[model samples]
Target: MRPLASLFKGWFLIRRDLSSSRRLFLTAVSFVLPLALWCLVSYVDWIWHPDIKLQLSSEREGNSTVFTAGDHISPGYYQEMVVATRAENTRLLASTPPPKSSKRANQKLLRQLAPVAISHDWLPYTEAQNDASIYHLWRDIATGTKIPTDPALTPENLDIVKQNWAQLAPLAADFSLASLPETPLLKLIPQGLPANPVYLPAPHEVWRSGWRDFKAVPPEGELSMTQRYQHSLRVILLGFFWACVVGVPIGILCGVFDFFSKLFEPFVDFFRYMPAPTFSTLLVAVLLAGDAPKIALVFIGTVFQMILVVSKTTRLLDPSLLEAAQTLGASPKQMLTRVVIPGILPNLYNDLRILLGWAWTWLVIAELIGVKSGLTEFIETQGRFRNFDRVFPVIILIGVTGFVTDQILSWLHGIIFPWTGRGNPIAQTFFRILFWPFRQISKLSDRAGTPT
Candidate 1:
């Protein structure tokens, strides 16, 4: 009981550091909470699913728009489709002499079964547009040779398949576009499972779409996912690198002496507030279109703020280090180099890490400012089409790229500055292994140099 109480007390201690287990638990909970809420809103039936995602759909006469599988519509709209389609179907069957339709039209009608067949694992998605395979699938499903489950065919949809197959089979045993029936075939009803609004797709949908998109081969003359990712990384890293190159020395000078500070910090402070993005049109006008303007925007956006933040971090260094250096007869150059720079390096690294993240916020805007390249362009195009499932992956990829890079930098920080007591265990272990021979040789030399 006492041990348990101590463990619990460690958890609730006010203004104190949490135990490592609690730290990991809270970190995990940070992600889990949002996902759990999303799952509740998505998977829990009768909660907030305001739309039905059509697993099967059809084309009506004289309408060029075709709603196929995976389309979303409001419940009211779905019901309207059902009523109108049923009415149109009745008119077709009751018409005297059973109104003839084009073989192409009936051929397309038979293909609506593709979604149902795919859902039941009776067909592969890549084979979807294969009319010959779709023809055979219709026969298999109608005769019950293929059983549908998970989303087993509703009795109504099953009946439509049987009836449509009856008309289709009479024309040809297998798929022959020319051999397709001239008679009208029954349209599959607009059937769907319950779904949330398209903007908030299910987690499975996001994962599946992400996988498919990443694995797919892009069209020729277009960029692949890797290429887009490389372009985005190039923009961010180049921007941050240029900012550091131009800003770090100025910031360090300002921190070390009042002369530089009075000359530079005042102007930097004033200019940072003017907004980096406001320069986009001017940049495009001067720099012209391409990666030049995009990279320049990131540099302009991040550099001013980087200078200010790094200057502040420099000033926060312990004055006692300066006092100690002065007492040792260190000159002004030695004081700046030996005392100030080394002392501020750790904090400056952290400051730059944060500023790197700040630079990423401008990525979408930066890409748009020029020729519209990188992941942002892809996101905008998909967003316009309202394919939210496809959109989530690109957004998630950007987030993940930043997160993993930060974590790697963080782990390396600890390894690179072990005296600061902030290195990763894995990094420390690797460092020890890699330097073992040198460390052993140094020990042997030290022992030989000592007098007995």
Candidate 2:
């Protein structure tokens, strides 16, 4: 109880000391309010823009029937179609097996049994049925089920079905069925419900689906999310390392030597304008695929930009500082090593941190060029499969990882340049908040030990 009281007291003291407490509060609210709004919008079925309730109609014209989107189909039309199909099937079964020469006639009769209006686009009923069939077929394939086909299905139709089946097979093999909702709320809504025909999934459902995908291991030799993240991190770090090695030295030379700056500045500036992804084919041709091309892609993306930034940072050094070092009998090498490097170290750290984030932005493009074994690959593949649940989570994961990485770098920067944080009000407030409870405990101990 005493510790808890002290903790609250410390929080109050820290809060009082931080003059920007209101700002901090607002910042927190800024994050929370959007999330709250997202949850609200997702959970509640608010009718913003209602779906256009299409009224489809069909009229007989000569030998064919014309259907229009504005026309309405009577319930009896569905019943008549069902009866006709059943009667035709019965007659086909009752008669002697058709000769091989009558195969075309059988196909024609099958088409008649499945008579669809020429203007199906205008027929809501036909469109809905078609959509539902396609949806179910996709669902079945996604769940690793082989679709059942009629034995008497024509060769042309069978070929078309086979082509679709082949295309969806990879998705089925890769898809994690556990991601789907066991009791989907969307199923409760009627197919032709007012306002919207499509289901707007709840936030919880999306989160659950994402979670499932995060934990799922793809079949075959494909990498999981964890493995992919590691690979991505490795590629980013390697590319960053190489970029720093080359760019920093060149930047320093450009900053220190007027001649070098004049010579290289134009070339670097020109290349910077050309996007890195455009070099993908060239990189592939030179590096010949594999991790080399991917790494080269990341390197190309970051290097030119890093060089320019570093050079500008170096050039911004105070002239007085350089003069003072020179006056103190400091050698050129010693001045660079001791004075210049230390002075720019803090800003350089900040620049590197910012550039590291930029490097992550290039990761997807890099991974796409040659190797597809990162978070980008998961996102791209799942996105193509229309697994928004999986895609959203991977995106969120990337954001969270970047945020954590930035924070870690910020902590490192403070450790390396302790003086920088001393003047920063935000940092001061943060440290006070961090150590307030310990300070409170110390105060209590001091009071108890005093001769009272």
Among the numbered candidates, top TM-score falls to 1
What TM-score does candidate 2 reach?
0.60
Worst 10-residue lDDT window, candidate 2: 184-193
RMSD of each: 4.3, 15.1
Per-residue CA lDDT of candidate 1, range 384-405, in tens? Answer: 8677777899999999988998
lDDT of 2 by residue, 148-206 (tens): 33112234333433444454455433333432222211100001112232333336645
For candidate 2, the per-residue lDDT at 398 reads 85
The list of candidate 1 runs beyond 4 A from truth reads 1-11, 60-71, 102-152, 170-180, 424-426, 435-452
TM-score of each: 0.84, 0.60
